[model samples]
Target: MDKQELGAFLRTRRERLRPEDVGLVSGARRRTPGLRREEIAVLAHISTEYYVRLEQGRAPRPSGDVLAGISAALLLTDAESEHLHLLAGTAPIQTGLHRRDVRPSILTLLERLTQTAGFVTSATFEVLAWNDLAAALMEDFGALAPADRNLARKVFLVSDGDGRGGPLYGISDRAEFRQTVVMRLRTTMARYPSDPAVIGLVEELRSGSAEFARLWERHDVQSVPMLTKTFRHPVVGDVTVDCDSLALTDRDQHLVLYSAPQGSRDAEALALLSVLGTEGIDMVPDARR
Candidate 1:
């Protein structure tokens, strides 16, 4: 069990709750945020001391019943409740390196996805494979070294050089995407805590980016779904597309497809990108180099 992380997660969730959120009265002006430990203990039907110990990281592995109580007390969502189980070692963990290999059929599907920008991302958000349209819509991932293909790295580490933030493909959902990256990485960390790459990547992001560090400390494990996004492509000006991410369950990866409705201007832009390829694109904006 990841005792420290579990404690941290519990603490964050508890602090996000208001007294009235769980039907408790706001008796007085509060000194700290969220419901108090005693209040949570009362709500969860556990001893205040034990809940405190759990938050202090001094408690033993909580039983399933105890965890359920705590989950209810904190009003965790389904994803957050599952994360609580993972952190407490009650759920099955991957316990190995995250898979990076893209299934051959997925690769073929990417190629067959005509006029659509398609790419597969590993558990850690590494771009494992992409079609020509993906390269055109984004940058040419095929030209980047394996280590440079990680989207989390690109999101947090690689800056746009104008003090804005990381290279976000000039996408309009930069903030949302960053949160999604952090939330998914938190899940990945719980699943593959022993994986060197995951460990190293988390360490690198925490140290390199203050934004990442702040988000990491929030202990969030759920991401709001991004339905549509607009990309300010250097060549195409703006191309808005519907975002569809299909989970490759066997490989623990995501096939992310960006497509615009047929007969739309965005669709025409995608078509143009398909033919242009990455001929005029540079992976990093020239100013960054």
Candidate 2:
């Protein structure tokens, strides 16, 4: 078990809960945030000392029953509960590097989506493959090396001259996208604790970006699906499109498609992107430099 991380996860979840949230009375002015440790232990039907040890990173691997009780007491969502299990070493963990190779059929599909900006991202958010439209809408992934194509890095590490994070192709949902990146990376790290690349990337982000460090400490595991997004394209102005992320479970990758309805203004913008293909505009900075 990752004792430190387990303790941290439990602590964060517990601290985010209020007494009223778990049906407990606020007997007095609480000193700390959320529900107290004693209350959590009481709700979980475990000893206060043991729960304290668990939160202190001094407890043994908790039994499934104990974990279930704690999960219920904390009122974790399904994703959060699964993350708790993963941190406590109670769930099945993927035991190797995350796959980067895209399925050939997926590559074919990207090519076939004539008007849509389609791309496939690895579990770590590396842009593995993309169509011409994707290259046009975003940056040209083909021009960069494998390491430079990670969306997480682009979102968190890359910044404008003022040191704030750069706009994600000037997407309207930049804030939500940052949250999604942290949530997904948290899940990825738990699943691939031993993978050097995963570990290094997370560490780099945490060290490089203060915003990333702040968000990482929250221990959030759930991500809301984004249905639509708008990008302030330098060439096409504002183009909004529907967002769809299809999981390629076999490879642990995602086929992300951005498209608009037929004959819509957004569709016309995408069509123009298909023809332009990063010709005159630099949507992204050169990562190689």
Backbone clashes per model, in order? Answer: 0, 0
lDDT of 1 at 212: 94
| 1-289 per-residue lDDT for model 2 (tens digits) | 8999999999999999988898888777888889989889999999999999999999999988999999999999999999999999999999989998888999898889998899999889999999999988887788899888998998889887667687778788888999999999999999999999999999999999999999999999999999999988878889999999999988889999999999999999998888878773664355223
Task: Estimate, for each residue in 1-289, the C-alpha lDDT of model 1 and write its tens digit.
Answer: 8889999999999999998899988887899999899999998999999999999989999999999999998999999999999999999999779999888988899899988899999999999999999988888787789888898988888877765467667788988999999999999999999999999999999999999999999999989999999988887788999999998988889999999999999999999888777874653377123
Model 1 poorest ten-residue lDDT run:
280-289
Clashing pairs in 1: none
Question: Can you tell me which runs of candidate 2 are displaced by over 4 Å?
Answer: 280-289
Error of 1 at 217 (Å): 0.6
RMSD of 1: 1.9
How far is 167's C-alpha from truth in model 1 (Å)?
2.9
Q: Candidate 1, 208: how far from true, in Å?
A: 0.5
Residue 85's lDDT within candidate 1 is 97
lDDT of 2: 0.90
List pairs with backbone clashes in candidate 2.
Answer: none
TM-score of 2: 0.95
Instruction: Write down the TM-score for model 1.
Output: 0.96
